[model samples]
Target: MNLFENAIKLRGFLAEDAKVPPSDGITEDAFSVLFLALMSGTWDIATNEWAPRTTVHRVVCPGPWFCGFTRGMKRGDYVEVEGELYIHDYDRPVVVEGERSTAKRYVSEIRAIQVRKLDRPLLVIDTGEDG
Candidate 1:
């Protein structure tokens, strides 16, 4: 037997408000999508310093419960998300080198099973000068 698993956990700030599309009357459950920005530091061996890096990720909150939970989140809010990774592939029209064409696009997103808002203060820097 072969065992497989796909899981991801991320801690970051909400890049924007949760996006929930209006119900189409086909599905009873509500769905939501969120953009999160994760920041980290990368160390450079030669430079002997650390550099900041930011990555934005798309998170999907499916079902009425998850959607409702995300509705309270807003931009700049720190949050933690736990979920599974999913990749969606679709065709999109594009113009490459002045030629119109259709291309296949792949989008990787996290299907969130758990989300939590963390109460943390933003970093502040003081220059010691008062105006």
Candidate 2:
């Protein structure tokens, strides 16, 4: 299942178990990451809509993988994805070399959704039904 669906299932299980660890465990971190990933589902696919000016990254395999930049990449500069730090062959995903505004905004938006709203659980994986 996708991150959201899995989060929902995991959340259900966690709620039933009184033995769940205090919220400071590594598992909690993992859960938080999962939550963010699920929250990013829409943006990941439609990133062009979010940052149309930015270059689109084409992964060799199917992916909506989260990429962290060591430095703000500029056009023609090389970038590394996953953990291949030594390989600088991957083209950076920005039209302007040092423009991190769009990328930062995308991430910040996802974070905003998570932190600003606390009324309901955000644990359902997107099935392309809700946009």
Candidate 3:
């Protein structure tokens, strides 16, 4: 098989190995709501203050701390978030300075891990589910 098929097979094996029995719900990070919003093309514009668009398809909670903590994450660190997503708009693009834009969207989660990039303020959001 080709590389893609190999990767898929490997992923299935990894999932089987990593799978754990579901536990009682854990507290998820707040930013997960924002994550969902960016993916679903929606945002909260209701408050129009800290989250000026309070009415957004707000995915990832985007808590005050999450926003602040992104500055502190290192190359190997992981962040966690828990929240829901709105389904209003996804107009503003998730633009990385150099990387090409993607059609893929964000998903909801309780927590995330942020892998730091060299010489950049943004971190790759490790949704715990996806890389």
Candidate 4:
């Protein structure tokens, strides 16, 4: 199987309330909305084995199916987000003096596919239910 098949789950409080903006794509109409924000701080590494493998922070933008939950979410509220992991390399233009060069910028991002608010005990839980 490919690396993308390995999905990870993260539980943390949002740095701020999610921002919902109308979709800008040509395919998207007025009904579209996006949830964009950062899942701040660090994952509870001691509680689970997956927490230690992730970065301290993650830029989360849940897909359309999960966007509804963002409307009532507030900063500091607990949330559980599931996403596929991928490492992206971007070419950033850097200039020293007058010469310009492109530098490789690597970013570890999780493209969130599903998100849910956590109201019960424990940061991470296996619901034992499938989609």
CA-lDDT, candidates in order: 0.86, 0.24, 0.30, 0.60
Which residue runs of candidate 3 sit more than 4 Å off their true CA positions? 1-63, 90-131
Per-candidate TM equals: 0.78, 0.13, 0.21, 0.58
TM-score of 1: 0.78
Which TM-score value belongs to model 4? Answer: 0.58
Cα lDDT of model 4 by residue, 7-122, tens digit: 87777666666665544422322121223344335456687543323224554564554445566677777777787777889999999999999999998766676777778455
What number of clashing residue pairs does each candidate have, in the order they appear?
A: 0, 3, 46, 0
lDDT of 3 by residue, 53-102 (tens): 21112223244444444433332222233322233324344568876564
**Model 4 deviation from the true structure expressed as Cα RMSD, one decimal place:** 9.7
Model 1 vs truth, CA RMSD? 4.0
lDDT pick, better of 2 and 4: 4
Per-residue lDDT tens digits of candidate 1, residues 56-111? 99998888777667767889989999999999899999998999999899999999
What TM-score does model 2 achieve against the real structure? 0.13
Report the lDDT tens digits of candidate 2 across residue range 29-131: 2222112111122344555544223323222211111211111222332222231111133333555666643322221111111111123444687688676
Angstrom error at residue 49, model 4: 23
Q: How well does candidate 2 match the true structure, expressed as C-alpha RMSD?
A: 19.4
CA lDDT for candidate 2:
0.24
